[model samples]
Target: MNKKRRLALAIGAGVAPLLVVTMPVSSASAHGYISSPPSRQAQCAAGTVECGPIKWEPQSVEGPKGLTSCSGGNSQFADLDDDSKGWKVTPVGSSTSFNWRLTARHATSTWQYFVGGNKIAEFNDNGATPGSTVTHQVNFGGLSGKQKVLAVWNIADTANAFYACVDVNIGG
Candidate 1:
């Protein structure tokens, strides 16, 4: 090859590798989880509780809507379903706030809070997009002591929903 051709080829080879390395990888588009009154995944992320893969990906416990599990039915995060995992329970009053930290905000349908088999609170967004942070005041009427609260974030345009479980000591 000529000198000019060899120089161009060498530069092309160097730039090709960088272009490939900088390319974005496909990942889940929706990411949000309870932060305050830290959810199981949050606890795992914070190292407050020793956990499995969830420790690395606390906001990725996503599954189909209407499922009732801390891990969002994701087997990789099934450790969140283990009640004996010694999750730190946050103490709260009768009515308290639950906060969420969103990494990728998507159009939301509703935010639901459930205790036991019954849904205690729900806030509908009507397909509106939310900010990076969201908070809701939930009243735990007639409920007391240690309780596991399941929070679901239903995406407006998809069948999937993000799930988080918050262990709280109400009236403690």
Candidate 2:
């Protein structure tokens, strides 16, 4: 090979890996999931809830906001949208802490919780990346009985939001 060609090949090999490392992919990757309260995805991961593809990758439940479907708006995990799936309800009071098992920590914009289509709690992350695990205390207000809670983790840098649908019984 020519000297110029050999030099170009060597430089290309070194720079390619750096480019890949520096560039973050925009696609969704497994990051955060509500583990303590056993969110729909968590229950699937734990085998307590028999789900489709979601059983393999629970933390990958992510999608943009404005869409009110479970499974983070991903049709692949549409099983989570099924209310008849017999999701186990975690007994909780008016106030309870929601724990997040973060695998790939990202700067967060906010965390929100909604029940019966009404927002019960919302907290700002202040554009900070959370720890490996994050716990947010949420007040359910006057809500009672079995209810479906939608938890959202809005990414600060991107337009995507990781979602976790938690089923809970407000009182014992």
lDDT by residue (1-172, candidate 1, tens digit) is 9999999998899988776555422132449899999999999989999998787767788899999999999998999999999999999999899999988898999999999979999999999999999999999999999999999999999999999999999998
Q: In candidate 2, what residue range of length 10 has the lowest lDDT sum?
A: 21-30
Per-prediction tally of clashes: 0, 0
Question: Model 2: residues >4 Å from true position, as ranges?
Answer: 1-29
Give model 1's TM-score versus the native structure. Answer: 0.84
Local accuracy by lDDT, each model: 0.91, 0.86
Candidate with the greatest TM-score versus the true structure: 1
Residue 47 of model 2 has an lDDT of: 95
Q: Candidate 2 at 171: error in angstroms?
A: 0.9
TM-score of each: 0.84, 0.82
